[model samples]
Target: MSKKENAAPTTHTSESLFGKVNYTWMLIGLAVIALGLLLMAGGNSSDPAVFDQKEVYSSTRITIAPLLILAGLAIEVVAIFKKPKA
Candidate 1:
């Protein structure tokens, strides 16, 4: 009985660093970033001499892609800093 009284307290912790919500947000951010990067790709002309200004300067690639990337980054930051509710 004395030995039990003197024993150290038990502390159980999760193996993962972040909770499920954080991981979910991280995954969403990664997907959004991937989509942005994919949108920024393509528009390559086979002939180097000939350039297609319209394809390279499309609204989706120039505007939407960057916005998506920024949104993803914001989400990632939020996910990293967000605390799990008790």
Candidate 2:
């Protein structure tokens, strides 16, 4: 066998590139997104004969939820691109 083939492979340490703050922010953003999605959910009627247009077209689901989702996305983007403190 060749010397290069016989030599052991070098391995780097198992460590995350992002700091704790980045991970925290990411989790927060995820939670916010989850909250937004939850707010937008559950507008269905139990009865087939019943239709609630007001419930389906509520401002919370249409405007507030979408805004919250967008804010969460922005937070995620900022967290991903943010530099760690020295």
Backbone clashes for every candidate come to: 0, 0
Model 1 — TM-score against the truth? 0.74
Per-residue lDDT of model 1, residues 1-86, tens digit only: 79889999999985767889999999999999999999989556778897778888889988999999999999999999999665
lDDT of each: 0.89, 0.89
lDDT of 2 by residue, 1-86 (tens): 89999999999897677888998999999999999999999556787687788888889999999999999999999999988775
Cα deviation at 71, candidate 1, in Å, is 0.3
lDDT of 1: 0.89
lDDT of 2 at 66: 90
Name the lDDT of candidate 2.
Answer: 0.89
Ten-residue segment with the worst summed lDDT in candidate 1?
Answer: 42-51
